[model samples]
Target: MTGPRWIAAAWGQSSLRIWAMAGRKVLTEGASDQGVSRLGPRDFEPALLTLANDMLPLDEVTRVLICGQAGARKGWVEVPHAMVPCAPHAAPPVPAPSRDPRISVGILPGLGQTDPPDVMRGEETRIAGFLLDRASFDGVLCMPGLHGKWVRLRHGIVQGFRTMMTGEIYGLIARQSVLRPMMDDSWDEAAFRHAVDESTRHPETIVSSIFGIRASALLNTPAPGLARARLSGLMVGCDIGAMRTWWHNRPVAVLGTERVSTLYASALAAQGADVQALAGDRLTLAGLIAAHERTGHLEPSAAAHG
Candidate 1:
């Protein structure tokens, strides 16, 4: 209670993000590439110590809170999951005993669905944060990332959710597949819209249309940005079309830290769905902070400052 009061961290497969908290207020935040996926089991201690060096408490105990893939089977520790239909704020944090006596870490458990066998890790924290802020948010949340998630929240509990590997597919094709050389980091709203419309109406044509990307660049030589947007639109369109049952005509919100969420917003909006965009990191931090407070780890004095 004398030094930095809380440490909140989100561990991903390829990235590790941290926040130093003075009670409920964040003092500083940082990120690194030393995610669990890239390190050995024994590397977590050194990795966390290095990343959190500046925020380490001096001669005082600091409560640490964590969420995301870091609690997965392959992460810092495999925390037990809380079943769905439970409040994000009510879900308990799994105590992750640490070797560092100055720090006690608690990882918020991710939500699980058993009907069709599905699970999520980090995104659940953001969901809790969003719901914490909105208080009354209901309907569907579309979180776009390496794996796109469509989650349903009724009242305050998560009813169910589904995942789509749209971004993964896009990355594979753009970075390693035949489309690699045909595009660059650029934007073409018109071309993207066209592809979205075409795909939304007839996703079955996706196989044939995918070939057109290579052909267009080879024959007509359209702008690289145009071809890139076309490809993105196609994949995003396919994802939305397939998940129409979950989001179609429903109140859909897009949450993410990148432009992909915006693309999803545009696609969902264009297709007659109510769309709202929520900033990513703030929600993630909010969720972590909420968990700390709920678990009686968040300091009341710090909460006021935040």
Candidate 2:
């Protein structure tokens, strides 16, 4: 695709973000064709290089703010690991480029301290921006994905979070595990609820329960829909069970696609908790725009147009 006249780029493992601004107005904003599962260092090079290349010819373009996971190490920003939960906020240092000049880059750090740290990459920075002045809730914020995050937020900062390999596990089991042979590709809500109920009741048996789909099919269980529901139940149930302590009595705000958020809502509601799902797109955009505003990259004229 041809580059836009002006652009703000944010890169991640799953997608490349571009916000193209013209004059004071954002003409368009969207992601690249590539998805995170297919992302690697090589894929990111072309994506960023292409944006930089495109920016060279657009004299109207004045600023480029790049942040996210893709900007770390092999790309733009670097930082030493820290052990504190809420480290002092620091802006990403200006990168010394290899050759590209059309794009100016900034990198943001992740949350936490450890090897397997909870890094925000691009979206975290944006989320930070969106969270400005939002009152802190002693609750959980669910960000769903291939690597879904169940975060504990206290007083407007992230205290701790656990990553659930729900999406990846679902993909693996649905395609390669024995469950694939007995399950249909379509969704069955009733069956899904049934599975949810069952998993909730017997949360400890999640692993074996996941494999039960194959056994049920082999044993001549009447409904393919039930089998599918069972699969869904196992994952959601296990997640709920694992997070029971973390989420107990806390309001849950899910941040992601409605479907995933709904599943989380259902699981939470079943346990008698107040839960809500926020629009993923809006939150992401708000977060990014907020970051720009915080850094003074977004001037009054830009704010008026935006």
Winning candidate number (TM-score): 1
Q: In model 2, which residue pairs have backbone atoms overlapping below 3 Å? A: 14-36, 68-121, 68-122, 69-121, 126-287, 126-288
lDDT of 1 by residue, 1-306 (tens): 533377899988898999888766878888899987898767776788788877875665567788888788877778877878777555677767578766666788888888867888888989888898677777899998888788998888888888888889888888888888887888899999999999988888887888799998789857858878999999989888888888876798899966778898989899999899888878999898777777753543234333
For candidate 1, the 10 contiguous residues with the lowest summed lDDT are: 297-306
Over 1-306, each residue of candidate 2 has an lDDT whose tens digit, in order, gives: 322234456666666777765533466666675543466545654666654554344333234556556556554445432233552234442442433444444444554535455555544553464365454666787777777777777765667677788888987888788777766766778777777777776778888887667776778854746776668777887777778887788888787778888887887787776788777666655555554555533433233334
For each candidate, C-alpha RMSD in Å?
3.1, 4.8
Pairs of residues at least 3 apart in sequence or in different chains that clash in candidate 1: 24-302
Q: Which stretches of candidate 2 lie over 4 Å from their true place?
A: 1-6, 22-25, 35-45, 49-57, 72-84, 87-98, 115-123, 296-306
